[model samples]
Target chain A: MRRDFLLSFAGHVLVVGIAALVGMSRAVRDTRRPIVFSVSVVSGGGTPLPQAGAQGTTLVESKPKSQAKAQSTAQSKTPAKGGGGSGSGTFKRQGLGVGVEGAEALGYSYYLNAMLTRVSDNWLNPYAGQAKVLTATVVFDIERDGTVKDVKVEKKSGDAAYDASCERALLVTDKLPPLPPEFPGPRLKLHLEFEQKP
Target chain B: MVPTTGASPGFLGPFIHAGPFALVDVIALVLMSVASWAIVLRKFRTLGRASRQTRQFLSTWGLRTRLGDYEQVAQRLRHSPLSSLLLAGVKEFNALRAEFGNSQAGPELLQHMIPNITEAMERAASREVAKIEGSLAFLSITTMVAPFMGLLGTVQGVLVTFMTLRGTQIPTLQTIAPGISDALITAVMGLVVAIPAALFYNYFVGKAHELEGDMERFESELTGIMRREIVSSQVEQRKGQ
Candidate 1:
């Protein structure tokens, strides 16, 4: 009986030690704040500005007054400079834009809009009050469950903070709305740009 | 559970900040879990050996006609409860025959002999059952008490959290999160300890009950065989006279 007790005590200690090791080995998870957005009601509040990194004729597009109105009115917005265009024309041009592939045919424009708002909410510009305009382009893959992966910088905006803020925004927005069920694909690859202007 | 002050809170923050009461609860649960697991292992080996030896004894005893034919098999199956039970009955039968003289036993004396032998086997069966069931009570007690011990820690931790908040102008998520997480750890630990103990306790109890039933059946069969052996020997002696 004493021998059995000793054996069991040793076995229990080993099991607990193994479990604790496994638990400690796992990476700690990151938690984030919820997203929030504000809407403006008045018109003539501003004139259009040149889209950042615009190489050719700078189309001075009017700022769409609201997110819902912007999507409906500007469905034909052309993809500008390597798959980088805003899903909605919001005025607060806060260093965040998304360009989705095959979004219109899949009727998943709302998914893009959600991605923009969520990423923009987390996207913080280090040079928020500076007059220097900067734009950094990043590309990444979005799995079906909305997990971001394989994030890489395609274009650097010449400023380290500006580029890092864009990367951090995407990394921190770890989850977005899941892809539309009608869209049949293993994952969606996305190209995005973060533009900071005075 | 004071708020962690560093730029990056360490992963072991909750455990490190656990109160005195919570630490005690954790220690108690850990000991209970270890003890319960020990009983599970020991009972497993004991019951398994008992079952295997009983099977061997029964198979060998089945081939033998005379009561004396069992002595060799019984010696080899010392761990078998059935063997011990049979030995008890046979020993009583031999003593009775010695007292009455093998050739002179009447039907009236035979009646008393059967009951005495049955009584002896009954005593041996109970002893074997007690040995099999030993230490199982500790498992039962652990299952019932570990959960409540965890709950006590949780309640104490929460109470401490609220008390800390009494002086604050406002309680924000950052202010209360650490304390609440510390409190919840004990509850999780409690369930971890109790679940396996409960499962193993039920299992060992069932095995012990099964062995007891087997012994009871063997006792009745052995009694019937001993009675017939006594009666047949008396008949042969009368014919010889």
Candidate 2:
């Protein structure tokens, strides 16, 4: 009987140890940022942002009026080039304008804010019962037209249901207000949080 | 009984945080508890009945003289271990008497009766033993498997705990303790279910063996009685001739 107890205890411990190790490795890998390039461009009439890369880019295309004023104020304090169209009103001219744009990009913040608002309003509230907090750093392209294209969830919510909800909400809302013309368009990191009420 | 104070909320509150695996383990433990209780109650009643009937049958057998009277007594004690043995012996005696067909007392007739009586007694012993041993195998299996089931639950709980810790800077005991606790509960439950089952199995087996030994002894005694009767009848027949 003593021998049986010992053997059983040993077996239990062994299973727990192996399971813990497997779980630990998976959790670690899941939490880390993958080292590969993951950004892609949304095709067709949707937000036409360039693919994300080493270069920082502003991706928000259509901003609400309040956001434009905030950008103008922040820009006035700094000596950097202002972000707006170069007066020539065409898609090609806007694209050319984006090529020369520097760091003062208000479009990225506006796009993120809009996405966050939508997430808070539509997805987060309805699914409070099933909500889980997830943090992701996404890379997307901002076409010269300030459209956010190809947003991805870099760090997924451990739960697929919650992650899918976040993804769907982002996809439904298209163009964000345009960034200031001087904003660079290489790759930008946006830290987003989705939280649910307890 | 005096009512005891209620348990503090936190006594088992920590286990709740052990996650889904812990919940599963708790459910399994509850099921095992119910099953163990059921087996204990059932075995208690069955063994009690068997013991009471055996004693009653033995007392009746001691007072009974005629074969017909013994047969009637056996019928009254219908599920008793003694009933089966008595029925087997009586059936064999009747079969032998019919086969002999009014012939004078002979060695062949007596030999046939003894072997038939022995064989019947053996068959009845085996059947009684099986009846008494019912549910003992289930108890043995529950004892053997409970620990492993508990371990499986514990492993699942530990896995969940470690997974929660992987990305963080350092895993602390506070973070890991609940998982370990959850896992251990399964092992505890396994032992709890197994111990009683094993004890009951052994107890029932011992009882069954004891009853079997009694039946074998009684068969020998009955065979001697029958032999004496046959010899006395033969002597009376010789005098009449």
Q: Please, what is the TM-score per model?
A: 0.63, 0.49
Candidate 2 C-alpha lDDT tens digits along B1-241: 1111111213343354556766677677656555655655666667777777888877777743445477677878876787888888777776776777258756347655677777887888788787777767777777777777777777776677677777865343334554576567767766776777778778877877777777777778677766665666667767878
Off by over 4 Å in 2: A1-198, B1-33, B63-68, B105-108
lDDT of 2 by residue, A1-198 (tens): 344345445554566578566654543221211111111111112211111110111222212323432443233221112121221111100121121111123333444333333333333222343334333334444443545567676666476765665555456545545544433332233323343322
Minimal lDDT window, size 10, model 2 chain B: B1-10
Q: What tens-digit string does per-residue lDDT give for candidate 1 at B1-241?
A: 2343322233454567888889988888878887887788888898889988887877777745568767777889989999889899999888877777443555448657689999999999989998989889998998898888888899999899988889775464445766877887788888888998899889888888888888998898898888778777777778888
- C-alpha positional error of residue B53 in candidate 1 after TM-score superposition, expressed in Å: 1.7
Q: Write the per-residue lDDT of candidate 1 for residues A13-80, one digit (tens) a residue.
A: 78767766765676344242211121111111121222111211112111222432355434444432
TM-score of 2: 0.49
Note the DockQ of each predicted structure.
0.13, 0.01
